[model samples]
Target: MKMTPPVTGTLELAHLLTRRGWLRTTEFNTPDCTVWDYAPSLPDQLAPEQKGAPTAIFLDNTGESEFYFVEPATRTTQWNPYSRNFDRLEDLIQWLPVIENWRAPRSHEHESPMGFARLRAQGLITTSEMMETLEHFPYVPVDPDAKVPSLSRTVAEIHQAHNDKLLSKNEFKLLTHNTFST
Candidate 1:
């Protein structure tokens, strides 16, 4: 599959899975979904054969015999290594909300992206950390799953979203306000 260029890698993978119409109906109907980020979390109902593994930022069906997973970076069919190395989504695609046609419609929401600001507000990602990260990388997406030189056990594992870059000087002021005494 030819992936979109502007928003390739992780963002594409994220958008494809969460977009309005891409999930398989029955699976979507299951209503037990979680965007896995290495933490072992699940919905109220659990599938007989489901457990949290060391997933970075993929979404998984918490109730499938095959330990079903959706890779957040590649959006490929993945199953538990113990159960099966590979699985095909051809069958599941039928019930999907819509065909996998990549199109990032221009929307207002796209204007301002959601990222580390929340983490910074919560004191998870500090201004110094963001500044430090900026020094190394001119612009960095707020994806915790992203591989970083320095990281703590933060909630968002901003996976290295190569396509989406955030360059904001104003952000530093907001995040660093409390760092300095008024």
Candidate 2:
């Protein structure tokens, strides 16, 4: 699959969240409000309008602001409290919830489609289990048993090194085609 564009707004929001000590977890709740964490690195598993969508949504149970989402395709950050979309981080920050004990968004909204609505009501999925192996695993080397340092991570490092002038374009291109030696 083609790599999606990185969302600066998402990172900016994450930075803002970490500063508040929310921490990452399946669920976080307090007397003032509740916060559910999620990432957009995975495929969408819910809402008909959102089926097959690749996006990240982090939401709070507080009623003031419904939730926030960053769509990589559009590079837009949206808030569903009243269905408001904001391109500027500052606009949302001023009204962002402080995190406390509160109720989460309702699971059943008359306007939502069945499949995605359930997933949305449950919060985004972070983990999954697949007992069966795929017919072909592209990331794995031709030798099904071949192992090395994480290929994806290694590729990232290779690109970084190339950007730092440690590797030429030809070197970087060739390196990507072969498994990392170290």
Candidate 3:
């Protein structure tokens, strides 16, 4: 048997996709922007509907406020560029427990803590195991006090280099692909 290659990207993207109904049959499209459309189902596991029914969203994360959605009943996609928005994929995922209706939505629900307690009570997990996991795999930390980099400055630099005939678009894409690939 052959093993599948792992997809490489920020864990933030994976967490977002996993949380947002994408554990089952999901459709991904890259239009002017990348969009991940996933089916609707229970949160316990990412299983597809046997009835072949699905609901979807076209997430346009290429900067602007463009986004879309599709439902099983209508069989039509609805585009809403400015209706809903997310600052980052992580924020999008934090809304999942509510969306899946596994637990009631409360403004002050401490999910991680509660989950740990439940698991411990069920004899499925221990505090030491949780501590070890955290110690071994820490959060990706960016300098909290550091100022954010300006995207325009980076873009302008690229444009100037291009106008000076430094590199072609194909070269740039190749460079990007290599940079992200392991």
Candidate 4:
């Protein structure tokens, strides 16, 4: 499937899956992409056979990606058009709430684009990280039965997500203050 250039890789996959009726329609974001690795994750829920499939782990400084879609009956990890490899699916899934809280549309909340931009303009997210996410999309593959990461783990891995740069300084400040506020 042709992916959307402006949208994150996870959104591209989520859009495809949602369009195909594989998952319920919901906002997609970096954190959401991260948390999709649980045994009860959308993929496993959609296709129970995929549980326990072998997973490919991809890692870097910023974050990681993973790939583990396989037909349980076949017992082979299949790389669909949208598969990524991460050190652990669990770490990715853990970030879902954060991303969602930060980016999802809400009746009373402003979108993160504005906030992210503000933060970028203020030099909070860092120009280097922004450039990286833009060049290489970060996504994770979910396998229900894959080994979970340890409690000592942080973000299974790290990758660049420059898309955050799209937001203006005001927008980013609003996003961070609103989403991350105590």
Better of 1 and 2 by lDDT: 2
Candidate 4 least-lDDT 10 residues: 102-111
TM agreement with the true structure for every prediction? 0.18, 0.25, 0.28, 0.21
Task: Indicate the residue-level lDDT of 96 in model 4.
Answer: 37
Error of 1 at 63 (Å): 14
Name model 1 segments beyond 4 Å from true. 1-53, 56-115, 127-182
The models' CA-based lDDT, in order, is 0.29, 0.33, 0.34, 0.31
lDDT of 3 at 120: 44
Of 2 and 4, the candidate ranking higher by TM-score: 2
For residue 72, model 2's alpha carbon misses the true position, in angstroms, by 22
Cα-based lDDT at residue 52, candidate 2:
29
Please provide, for model 4 over 15-89, each residue's C-alpha lDDT reduced to its tens digit, 9 standing for 90 to 100: 543453333322322321222222222122224434232222122223233442221111224433223333443
Residue-level lDDT of model 3, residues 68-143, one tens digit each, is: 3322111213321112343444444553332232221111122232333344446665645432221221111133
Which candidate do you rate higher for lDDT, 3 or 4? Answer: 3
Off by over 4 Å in 3: 1-11, 19-28, 41-53, 64-83, 102-182
RMSD per model, one decimal: 17.9, 19.6, 19.9, 17.3
**Per-residue lDDT of 125 in model 3:** 59
Error of 1 at 32 (Å): 20
